[model samples]
Target: MKNIARTLASLLALALTHAPSALAQASCSSDGTPQPVAIFERFISADCEACWSDAATPAPSATAGAAVLDWIVPGKAGDDAPLSAAATSDALARLQTLGRKPPVATDVHTAAIEATMPARLRVAHGMPFNDYLGTAIAFTPVQRAAQRTGAAPAAMDFYLLLVESVPAGTEGTKVARNMVRNMLHGTLDKRNKLSKSEQMKWMETRSMRIPEGAQAERLRMVGWVQDAQGRVIAAAQSTCR
Candidate 1:
């Protein structure tokens, strides 16, 4: 059984390493920039107008080394909802993925990985064409100085988020927010049996639609990896040149 799993993982790794032109076109990346050590997610309901303007919104400090993402969830009011235009099904899906119910107003969750990262996780996007944007996320694990003895997990989950940077005072909000516009999810098999000369890496690429009213220039990509036990292992946010 272990050999079979390793065989499958090896095939997946080969596919990722030799990815086609789609990956070549993925121009924007977080490769050279410093990666964030934590993620701060905020979910707000469209029906609750006050939620957007809430004065108590949590804002991570610039020096905190965290990526903050805001998600506007669809509410019961449908089209009549105040922030309905900005709401997306992806938000609800994310909540479900986290095993949480929609908040009546707003909710915040934080996941912090390490003070000094041991893995490289990057997110990137290409130039937009036909209202679609090419995006990708990659992860490569590095041996820690003090290597642990346990075997690697069989798989890890990845999340690539496209968010619009909304400045403060734009919607009567006192704090700036990186509002999530779209998201891509993937699973990375870590069971590959690699030769000493081979590099073990996992990657996924996709085309994401740019939501209406979302400025392409303001869009940024954020990505994170979670182990099988749901512990975050790495996080990164893109910075366009």
Candidate 2:
């Protein structure tokens, strides 16, 4: 009986040793600490002759943590255009909600740059046309002390913008910039009046039908969290590989 027990134990140990190791599950959390940064959004139309000058102005490779997005309005009395009707409608709605005008350029070098900055937000990934573009974001109370005082806001607005980095337009005489191809917006729950250390996780997934002439490889995403007054509190962006 002792030998039989010993043999069974040896077999169990051998089986365990030969078994395939389980793969670690992938984490959906954002990579690093969320930092405050500005969110710069622009609306432009191809039909407007004045817009070409703004489009001609060189854009920086980076915005110093700011998420920059440009929305090109489609079908505005032009033979050559970039965005589709659906995309244009979506962009227009967002601009209207924020009470902003199109084709207006903002100086990135001034304090006005921070006017619409985001407090702290992280982006997981920004793969465009890869089945779906998705991001996982976590928001913590910026003012936990205010929460204790029962002064914290009940909720915050979040927006995920899908932008396409279009190359110089071969089909038209006009040039193209980093244009916002689509946008998604939602409200996150801050109803609990989160403690200073507590955080709320949110996920946004969007599957986009690539516009006929739009290049999928040049797509990216920008995401931002905004306060009740429409001021962006935090922003981040990811580029597609």
Candidate 3:
């Protein structure tokens, strides 16, 4: 069973490496600037013995341009007590909205491996809410010339994420990577359709409580845009000032 899983994972890795998309390319602009990336958020429980491997998975370098968020929750598949109830609830809501099953250790490996891929959109000018109340994300439309040669979707969905970089964790254990504290979802204006002629701006703000264990200085805001099919178009991250 382990061998089968390993083989499948390897195949998937190969596919992602060669996949052609704005997100899969090295540079999205003629000037050699990399496009913004999508956020890779993973949900897990500390008590789940199977989740340790994933929690230990290292994050992609900042140069990769992917912001990873890890949500630690408590439940049947989670720990006896979550590090932050607000964070857990936020993650649960996102997974439910996406109709995805609770993530296991393998999912973490998948996210880390996939982080190397390019992103379809770029996240720019991200900022945290005043008083640590929430975060604001700006969705800037991709330039027509920079976009992949394909029909643009009539509309897109946007999600705002509050992420904490590496936080204090148990000694001798794999360090927890990016941890998502909250998320806010929104849809772009259909009339605007994210046209390249003018950068269609979609902004979102989400209020959240930073977990007790999180380092306030390490907080970040991530913004991602997706199409109607739930395909990520672009993503970006910014640190709290």
Which is superior by TM-score, 2 or 3?
Answer: 2
Please provide TM-scores, in order, for all candidate models, with all chains considered together.
0.80, 0.59, 0.58
Cα error, residue 152 of model 3, in Å, equals 8.6
Which residue window of length 10 is worst by lDDT in model 3?
A: 22-31
lDDT of 2 by residue, 164-230 (tens): 7655654242555566766667887754223444543333333443455566667655666766776
**All models: lDDT?**
0.76, 0.49, 0.49
What tens digits encode model 3's per-residue C-alpha lDDT throughout 215-239?
6666665666666666665656653
Candidate 1 weakest ten by summed lDDT: 8-17
Q: Which stretches of candidate 3 lie over 4 Å from their true place?
A: 1-38, 49-63, 77-79, 82-87, 103-106, 109-131, 142-153, 167-173, 190-199, 206-208, 211-213
CA shift of 16, model 2, Å: 32
Q: Clashing residue pairs, candidate 3?
A: 23-118, 23-119, 36-122, 70-178, 70-179, 121-233, 121-234
Model 1 regions more than 4 Å off? 1-26, 61-63, 114-117, 143-153, 190-199
Instruction: Report how far residue 224 has shifted in candidate 3, in Å.
Output: 0.7
lDDT of 2 at 166: 55
**Pairs with backbone N, CA or C atoms under 3 Å apart (clashes), candidate 1:** none
- What range of 10 consecutive residues in model 2 has the weakest lDDT sum? 20-29
* TM-score ranking of the models: 1, 2, 3
What lDDT is obtained when candidate 1 is compared to the true structure? 0.76
